[model samples]
Target: MLHLILPSDLDALRELLDENPESLLDVAAVVNCLGTCGLCERRFVPVAPLVESLEPLYGDSKGLHALLRHNQYISLSEAICGFCHADPGLLNMFQKMKKL
Candidate 1:
């Protein structure tokens, strides 16, 4: 299983932070995976640049923690993962809309 970071994931993470202030720990846990599939045990190449880029978007560690605790963030993560894994068409549509 490929484990590339998706823009939707970032957006979801951001939305999550916006909705709550205590989800940072959860977000950190997810980020720590570093491309290893939790279920399949498949090892994917780590995208360091992608991860680095996300760091600033969340501001500080505290900010990230808040996001993790946010309900919206959790929901967004589920939606993003569903789109990425089961509905690429939906993801593409969302990306296209963002371009406009």
Candidate 2:
């Protein structure tokens, strides 16, 4: 049961990174701090490699062009297609505002 970070969480993290440029390490630390029951925690997965792997895949012909066209490669999971994640909270909020 990987407690995946919601879209809002990612957005918040991005904003945090922007605000405290020196806290880049802290940002990584927080992202790696998954809950005890999640797949990330169980597997002890480090986010560094994941972030590295997504760098080159963000550009064209990488199969993620559509999803990451506007977003820089900030993290691995962030590079994932929004449609694939289908975050419930984000979708619900968008629906309420008629923005979906």
Candidate 3:
């Protein structure tokens, strides 16, 4: 299956983050795949609840430890700048909303 972080996916993620900032750790900043990008295509997969786990961080450091070792978390600043700078190949597919 094709897995990519598309513009819509990013937008949805942003909304999700706004609603649930705690999920920050569960998300992966980038995923790459080749296909029609950002058309909201049924074929294009969305990354959400799937990559994110609902479990809270317990005293056990395994989850946080693994995240730190993995080094996959993107800073809030970087996530804000994600609009102009995302996976280049994926950015190429971003369909900017047209003004009416």
Best by lDDT: 1
Cα TM-score per model? 0.25, 0.22, 0.21
Q: What is candidate 1's CA lDDT for residue 45?
A: 23
Sort order, lDDT high to low = 1, 2, 3
Put down candidate 2 lDDT per residue, 1-100, tens digits, no spaces.
1123212354454454345433333333445532121112222222334344333322222433223233322223422323322456644554565543
Predicted model with the maximum TM-score: 1
* Whole-model lDDT per candidate: 0.41, 0.34, 0.32
Q: Candidate 1 vs candidate 3: which has greater TM-score?
A: 1
Model 2 lDDT, full chain set: 0.34
Q: Report lDDT (Cα) of residue 21, candidate 1.
A: 38
Model 3, C-alpha of 84: deviation from truth (Å): 35
Candidate 1 lDDT over residue span 3-50, tens digit each: 233234656657765655344433334565324432233333232322
